[model samples]
Target: MLSPRFQGLKIIVSDSAMRELFKLGKDMHDVLEVLESGYDAPRKRKAGTIERWLDKGKKTVNAIIALDYNETMQEECWVLVHFGKFARNKK
Candidate 1:
């Protein structure tokens, strides 16, 4: 189950990320679900970069997001930069 706290969080997806999702035949709702329920941790890519991992059936999906804490909105905004099936040491 997704937490109620996530209900107010704003989600933003980049154009490239959207294209990747379309190419992978993945749904935005599924990605949002992952963001809402997955375990998240800070990434070394940048100061605000975060990596969210979600287990779907037997596979794990990873979403890289840039988090912004908005004072006016009083909510955390997530900008999805990349997302795909978890690949270990592909680079």
Candidate 2:
């Protein structure tokens, strides 16, 4: 059983994607923590979730791109992971 703190996270992921991303490798929570800390640490701590930070990061990255600015691949990956479209290829 997960803590009530994590209950808010339940709806963040779809059933299928949650199953896929929840177990087999990187825990989504940990990933969200990392990304959230990178972008917004204090706010993340308050919300007890990283979803908003991830959304902000995505918006920031897109804004940068839209402005015809350059961002590193690493920067783009932050937004991509939340999307669940491309899973990291196991090597």
Candidate 3:
């Protein structure tokens, strides 16, 4: 069962994203949690990308998504392009 926050939101996982998710041992629940509660930020105009951050219990995960707004259907769909742990620069 999906959480209420994910209701009416269409999510598509890309091949690359699926591979990354498997590599990171993340499932759809993790992705949905990020989309529901993570910090959302706008990205470049290409494909209407958006960046989101999810705070797991031990670490944070970052997700890149491409969004499409369907005016005819009056729906918003998003594709997960990439997702992985949030890497911090160690300077």
Candidate 4:
């Protein structure tokens, strides 16, 4: 449910991701902050989901957001596909 500051960019949060956000231990507000700030960097087309360290705190949250541009609107479309926390070792 987050929108980009730039009008040219259209970001969408998947329904499944939204439902699982609580597991990330971060509220929507915090996610918006990190995502908005990430806009400063250039986003490229992505398909393969990969976990990247979010530049928010001490590298805690790992999220995968795929990017694809819409030719009709000529705008960048970002979709937050998935996210999760680091797992602790269990013995």
Top candidate by TM-score: 3
RMSD of 1: 5.2
Per-model TM-score versus the true fold? 0.63, 0.26, 0.67, 0.50
lDDT of 2 by residue, 8-91 (tens): 222233355445454545455544443444344233222222333333322321000011111432221211224222222245
Question: Where is model 1 more than 4 Å wrong at Cα?
Answer: 1-7, 41-45, 68-76, 87-91
Model 3 agreement with the true structure over 4-90: per-residue lDDT tens digits:
224466777789999999998988888877877898654444546777887666667887777766565587877788888965444
* Candidate 2 vs 4: which has more TM-score: 4
Alpha-carbon local distance difference test for all models: 0.73, 0.31, 0.74, 0.55
- Better TM-score candidate (1, 4): 1
Candidate order by TM-score, decreasing, is 3, 1, 4, 2
lDDT of 4 by residue, 1-91 (tens): 4455323446566787776686666655565555544433234434533334445444445455667666766877766676555543345
Winner by lDDT: 3
Candidate 4 local lDDT, residue 82: 65
Which residue pairs clash in candidate 1? none
lDDT of 1 by residue, 1-91 (tens): 4422334666677799999788888867878777778987445567767777887776678878787776766878877789888544434
Rank the models by lDDT, top first.
Answer: 3, 1, 4, 2
Worst 10 residues of 2 by lDDT: 61-70
